[model samples]
Target: MTMDELLHDPEFIELIKQYIDYLKSSVLEINTKLANGEYHDVMKFGHNIKGSGGGYGFMELTDLGKALEIAANDENKEECQKYLDLIEKFVQDKN
Candidate 1:
């Protein structure tokens, strides 16, 4: 959806802010895990991100998170990093 269409709901926007905070925290945790080679935790984090992003109506983020989750599950570190970058870009552009 376009930014104008997505921004129409005040309540949703508020919820999105909260979710974005959660996303940021989760991203940090995931980064820490990845840094330590804790791949399973990273996968779990990506799964959480995917669910929460979809719940908050950030479909692009949701898709990116899903791809990350899948890549994590498959032990495809490069693809997972790509998806992570996509999600970061989406969040940065939106905010």
Candidate 2:
């Protein structure tokens, strides 16, 4: 189902909203930690997103998160930035 449809449904709307908030917070946290040269939190956040996105019916996000996790683990800032950019694009496109 599309995001609009999900939002239209009373049951899923609140959950979706919460997920969006989570995504926003996750992004901010990742950015902060990355700026501090901390890869662990970035990896942790990516792993959480990878595991939870599909549960929220957002497999695309899960894919991006997986890429982010891998990049962070490898300490590849460029690759991690690429994945983070993709994730931001995904969020913008979806919302």
Off by over 4 Å in 2: 1-8
Provide TM-scores for the models. Answer: 0.78, 0.84
The whole-model lDDT of each prediction reads 0.74, 0.83
Candidate 2: residue pairs that collide: none
* lDDT (Cα, 0-100) at 83 in candidate 1: 73
- What is the alpha-carbon lDDT of model 2 when measured against the actual structure? 0.83
Tell me, what's the RMSD of every candidate? Answer: 3.1, 2.7
Native-structure RMSD, model 1: 3.1
lDDT of 1 by residue, 11-58 (tens): 768878877776666666776666677778878877877787766667
Candidate 1 regions with alpha-carbon error over 4 angstroms: 1-7
Identify the candidate with maximal lDDT: 2
lDDT of 2 by residue, 1-95 (tens): 88668758887977877888778767877887887879888898889989999877889999989998998999988888788778777766666
